[model samples]
Target: MSQLTGPVPDTVFPRLGWVDDLVVPALREAVGALPAAEARVAGYHRGWTEADGAPVESTPRRGKAVRPALTLLSALAVGGSARDALPGAVAVELVHDFTLLHDDVIDGDALRRHRPAAWSVFGTSAAVLAGDALLVAAMRAVSDVPCRSAAAVAELVGALMELVEGQSADVAFEEAPAVSVPQYLGMAGGKTGSLMGCACALGGVLAGADGERVGGLREFGRRLGVAFQCADDVLGIWGRSRRSGKPVGSDLAARKKSLPVVAALAGEGAAARELRALYASPHPLAEQEVVVARELVERAGGREAAEEEARRQLAEALRALSYARPSADVYRQLQEIAWAMVRRDA
Candidate 1:
């Protein structure tokens, strides 16, 4: 087993060599099954290939791979081998990539993982098409898993439907006058939680764990997913570009109604009015305006409210973990990862 103490490791599966050493290879192979141009775009988006199709000089951090880690770890928690869950892990990762590719296009994000987004380098059509290809590829990745592969695919597709609904709601929110806290949380749960829950549940399903245990794992992942999003919202407004690999206050610049921003708008008095007006402005925010927006979010108690909610969700996640009945070592590792995710600055 890998060390779980000290600072957070470089990868979500720092202890599980197979996640990086084995699953990644299989994922790449699965991605390679796409058409040549689509495969090139996918590889480049995954930090494996240059724009021109040459291999990258060194490995780059594609993403946290938290969903895949949860899938493999949940399998181990239920007394199954990590290898047994590799197909599920790969499927979840592909689904995640598909969402990101389309989200980048929708949000007009120029940067991802400290490089140009696929939509920015390639055309929007290529990015969207590649995303569609990934969804199809993800289904193929899990189609041949023994025993419960068909059921797993059904679960993933259901989660994808939920994700689509959440994204649609998010887009609609841009034009709405107000969004309640519950509504925002519900959207976050759908957009971020559904797939995470499915990832954990797949482990238990594949391991033949009891329904109660699978449900517990699913709930644990759901709560953790909310906590992750809350922390991410915090980072979006105030985190350093160097650490987050995006411009400071990028959400503000885009006029995005993130958790903290929404909470701030709901506050009383002059600050809220100022924030509302700033958001309503037609032009992109200037750098100074972005700084002001960040300050306004902090001063209006939005940051505090969002942080407190994250802590609450984290506590709830730990409560769910108790019912999960994970092994002693696995429990420790899960706790560490949970804290790292909920408490992270970037």
Candidate 2:
């Protein structure tokens, strides 16, 4: 429940400052190439109104393109040029944005990346359509990659299936009586980890990397994704109250079945009873209950356990990288990115 401030800790890899200059432009270009497609779909939602209205400025504004960057970097690590992997990178990013568009609608989230969510502004129906548009666009973009192998297409499809399954599990957990730690991990793996795994795997496959080496990259991404979700869970509860742009213990308020809460419940101690009572209560959690929830998570060792779990996943990610056969420098940079995922503040 402690607040995190200042720079994230450096653990396994040195930060590479060059990714901004090297990778981002490629991503932009890949996305830019689809303007006609995005515009066509935008028409479906608003029709002539959209065309007559001031253009939705193509501002270089979006959430951190971390997933796409991972795809590009993974390809580079395997000796492929970023340009060569642009299609795969764009495909993954489109899929991610599509998920977010739908997720915000389902979760009733009003804001995303500091802006009104697509659903909030466009209405749920339009938002759903936009999400579908993005998915179709993603497939089209990837399909345009000349000479793409069948195996690569299959991997992308598999990732999409896993993503849907994970999202379904997440929604189901909200109403379920109890969620075990393993179940939560599996959900995170399916929702977030699968896409990341595909990102790395696509990179390797495009570069024609050996199967064993590609498998290693996929493992690296999977572990990193687990660690990333663990860190996010910690932040959802304990990060700066204002900067998080949500109430403290917002997860508790929403009755989210996160790792720490599930762990505290499983312990069958005072914390568990208190949580069950609070959750069962008709009244909203007052400030005092928030404090109590924090205490329960702490006293039950949930925070420490979650952190340890993140570290374990991070170690697994590093181990996978060690076997990936990347050039020493590329391997170092990729490892750095993985460490950054665990250590990021937001």
Number of the top TM-score candidate? 1
- What tens digits encode model 2's per-residue C-alpha lDDT throughout 257-292? 777777777777777787777666655567777778
Runs in model 1 lying further than 4 Å from the true structure: 1-13, 61-63, 242-244
Identify the runs in model 2 with alpha carbons over 4 angstroms from their true place.
Answer: 1-6, 9-63, 241-248, 282-288
Give the Å shift of residue 183 in candidate 1. 1.2
lDDT of 2: 0.71
Q: Per-prediction TM-score, please?
A: 0.93, 0.84
Cα lDDT of all candidates, in order?
A: 0.81, 0.71
Candidate 1 matches the true fold with a TM-score of: 0.93
Per-residue accuracy of model 1 over 1-346 as CA lDDT, tens digit each: 1111123445544565556765788889889999988899999998899999999999654436778888888888888888888888888889988998998999788988788999999999999999999999988877888788877787788888988988888888888888877888888888888888888877777777787888888888888888888778887876543233566678888888888888889999688888988888877789999989888888887888788778888788878877878999887777777887766554
Give the Å shift of residue 100 in candidate 1: 0.6
- Could you tell me the TM-score of candidate 2? 0.84
